[model samples]
Target: MHAVLLLMMMVFAAVMTGCSSGPDYKIDIIKELYYQKDKPSPFEIKVTEAGKAVTGLTVTADLSMATMNHGTVKVKFAEGKDGTYAADVKVPMNGKFEAAFLLKKDGEKTEKVIEINVVKPEGVAKINGQWITDKDVSFYKFINQLQLEINRDAARKNYSGKQLEEELAYLDSQEKVLDDQNKLLTQIIRLRSMALLAEEKGHKVEAAEVDAAVEKARGQYAQFASAQALIQHYGEEKFWDVEKQQYKLIVLAQKVQKDLVDQAKKENPKAGDQEIYYQAQKQYEDLLISQINSLKIEIL
Candidate 1:
């Protein structure tokens, strides 16, 4: 009986030792950090072992998407005097970004998903009470940056004589695209203002849907570095605020289109399909452009 009791006590002690042997790795995600979409952004991840610092462990961050077009970004961890694990992350866009981190120590493994909400620059560029929104400015900057690029390229190649003239003519012809962009910009501003009005009138965009739509925009610009770079150039918070404005414009544009279609149907129910459709779209786009120019825009 004495021998059996002693054996049982020994086994219990061994089990307790095993349970207490390994360090409990804990990962805490810090929120609301800002980073440029084009450059590396640093994020803090706090790790604790039984509420104490877990030193000499490795941590890494990995981002995944359906298609590998954007590629992946990773950062290793270094010990900080604050007893927290620090890693720099390069967020590609203001989309549905997911990050996974791996923590390893003494043959033990831990994984965590850190939520990253990267927004476009805030106050990117604001126009009067209703002419433009942050998104319009972001997009404008993006398109203007493209124009800037063409100019840069032409300058670098030293185009002169007919070449320079031809280039100038081409640039001149692109005035329409600029016009369209300006129109779009106006529409975006109007839309944001309208959305604000809508919300005041008890209309609200579904949160999940807004999130999904924002993600869709990110997906659309996934390929264009100019777009992404300009966004990053402004930084994330402002960038996202701009994105929200863009979304509002798009929604407002759709609403305006729908209203026009409804009016056409009412005025001339038998109107030819192409006539009403074509005129409405053109008129709507024009209305927006005109309004944008009409507004007081201040750029700093």
Candidate 2:
């Protein structure tokens, strides 16, 4: 009986030791951005305890300029994938910024501070004469949606263990795919910039044309039970506004392209339709490339 009692006591002590050795809470700042005025600067923070992601935590940041006497800017972070918290903070101006992060989980709170050197980046992304941070944010949202769709398809196929990991790894390593997506985004931005230039040159698309284009797009979804339901499913007000604006921009771009092609054909009256179009496209792309090359584009 005494031997059995001794063995039981040892087992209990071992269990306690294991429990006490579990992970402690920790925070890591993964990504920092250069501070810009009135622009959303994004930061990525990862929270873990014992090297495992900690979910359901409330995270916020207090940002202040380190070198100068700038007031604090408070920002609430939103939860992202893999125990990461993300927030877009706007600092007053460029300088050394100190960010103090407060993390709260289950009534327990922890604090961490990180210093970031903030300077105006030459340019991460741009088109023509316009900065495209807002457009890049929208582009990232589309990229994230595509990633989610890929994950969903993978899950549906029941890919598990090594096979699943390999599949995802392969997808991540597809530089060509990512490059193509970026090129497409750049093309879209180029088109929008061209439209803006056209507008500056006193070329405009009528509101009636935009409205007609939107109505035609809406008509494609007529099989849906209700327009309201379709709109809601696609994000309602914001989606419709963006949709209309995109259509307007596209119409303007098409008009500009047509004008350019017509001018090219007028200059070369004996040229084939294909030849004129090719020349016009080449001219447009060359102009865009020249403008882009003039800007300092730094990919972050």
Candidate with maximal lDDT:
2
**Model 2 lDDT tens row, 51-104:** 899998898888898878879989899999889888777778887888787787
Clashing pairs in 2: none
Total backbone clashes of candidate 1, pairs 3 or more residues apart or in separate chains: 9
Q: How many residue pairs clash in each candidate?
A: 9, 0
**CA shift of 282, model 2, Å:** 2.1
Models 1 onward score TM values of 0.35, 0.43
**How well is each residue in 1-300 modelled by candidate 1, as lDDT tens digits?**
999999999999999776553445667753233446566555666787678866777778787543335677677877675457766666666555567777777787677775566555454235552334454554665655555555645543688778778877776676666545555555445665444434444555566656777888777555555556656776767767766755655664566677677877777788898888977877666765666565554322
